[model samples]
Target: MNRTLTNTVKPDVISDFKEITKMRLAVSVVFSSVAGYFLGAEVVNFVVVLLLAIGGYLMVGASNAFNQVIERNLDAKMNRTKNRPIPAGRMSVTTATIIASLFTILGIVVLYIINPVTAMFGGISIFLYTCIYTPLKRVTPLSVFIGAFPGAIPFMLGWVAATNDFSIEPGTLFMIQFFWQFPHFWALGWWLYDDYKRGGFFMLPTGKRDKGTAIQIILYTIWTVVISLIPVFGVTGRLYLTPISGVLILILGIGMLYYAFKLYKNKDEKTAKQLMFASVSYITLLQIIYVLDKFIRIWI
Candidate 1:
């Protein structure tokens, strides 16, 4: 009986840890950082890359855990978030806070080993996400704009980790991710508008998923596509892309843009959800293309 109880409790604890850290989302963030590392490093360092992945994940996870703690009560009010570990009574606030604190410390130390600049940006990401964006979510839709700062950091953070410098290359990477977030998140905001409303969170630009929000999504999508092509013109220093890769990225951008337009035209939950998924695919593929292009260029 005691063995059975121990086994059951162990699994529940592990599951709760996953929930508190938002494991999938954290891993996705780590992917972005690793991709950036590859793009920036002329010669890849596998050890540094591994450290970046671990540090990135821990930082993102810490931010998410802290967010869950802060929003536990509000999360309980929303159907979408009601089943989260904290809201479902599977975890205590004190336990979550302790875990977040440890993650924060360890994440910073690991990133600092890469470079001071990388660690500084990582710290900034956590601070902005937890201290600023989390509270602003309930007060204004501008929170999304504020949130983009931290969200964009991971991509550039990897670049800084590889190069140990902050320059136009990383800045351009930052801009691309920064603009991409508006369309990606606004689409998500539209799809989850009703659920978000229950938590008193303002996500959409116009706060009601109307034409204004759709227009903003379209504009940002356009900006994301345009910025992504800038590296092809030999203006972004070490971040130049081959003409072939540039054209391929443009095509990918247009594919995502098509879904954004669909959301604008349809103005429904299904369309918004489609755009959200498209945006995710677009960013992921774009990173893969960038890394692949660099390797191909090196090999040839």
Candidate 2:
């Protein structure tokens, strides 16, 4: 009876931990950082990549955990977030706080082992997300703009980790992800506008699914495509893209742009969700293409 009780409770505990950390989102963030490491590395270092993956995941997880802790009461009001561990009453505030604190300390220590610069950026990401972005969400829509800073950091953070330098190469990487966030997140905000309003979060720029918001999404999508092509001009230091890869990336951008325009025309939840999915695919595939193009050029 005792053994069975322990076994039954263990899975619930693990599930709660995964929910608190937002394991899938953390893994996706780690993937972006690893891809950036590959793009910046001259000779691949498996150990450093492993360390980056671990440290990046921990830092992202810690940020998410702290976010949940800060927004626990607000989260309880939203249908989407109401089931989360903290909001659902499965986990106490004190327990979640302790877990978040442990994650923050462990994550920083792990990142610091890589180098001071990498660790510093990791710390900044957490601080911006928890300290600045979290509270600002309730007050204004500018929170999304501020949140993009931390969201954009992981990609370039990997470059800094591999090269230990801040230059045009990492700056280019940063800008690519930075401009991409607006359309990506705004689509999500549009789809969940009601739920977010319940949580007292202001996510959209215009605070509604209006023509103004759709136009801005289209504008940012255009900016994302343009920034992605800059490396092909041979001006971004070591981050040059071949013509072939540039064309392929252009095609992918056009595909995402199609969805962005669709949302603008339809102005409905389903269309907004489609744009959200397209934006996610666009960013992920863009990173993969960039890394693969670099490796292919080196091989030739």
Per-model lDDT? 0.94, 0.93
> How displaced is residue 57 in candidate 2, in Å?
0.9
lDDT of 1: 0.94
How many pairs in model 1 have backbone atoms within 3 A of each other, for residues 3 or more apart or on separate chains, i.e. clashes? 0
lDDT, model 2: 0.93
- Candidate 2 lDDT over 1-300, as tens digits, reads 999999999999999999999998999999999999999999899988988998998898888999999999999999999999998999998888888888888888887887888999999999999999999999999999999999999999989989988899999999999999999999999999999999989999999999999999999999999999999999999999999999999999999999999999999999999999999999999999999999998999
Candidate 2 lDDT score at position 171: 96
Q: Measured by TM-score, how close is model 1 to the native structure? A: 0.98
Q: Write the per-residue lDDT of candidate 1 for residues 99-181, one digit (tens) a residue.
A: 99999999999999999999999999999999999999999999999999999998888899999999999999999999999
lDDT of 2 at 27: 92
Model 1 residue 100 lDDT? 99
Candidate 2 Cα misplacement greater than 4 A, ranges: none
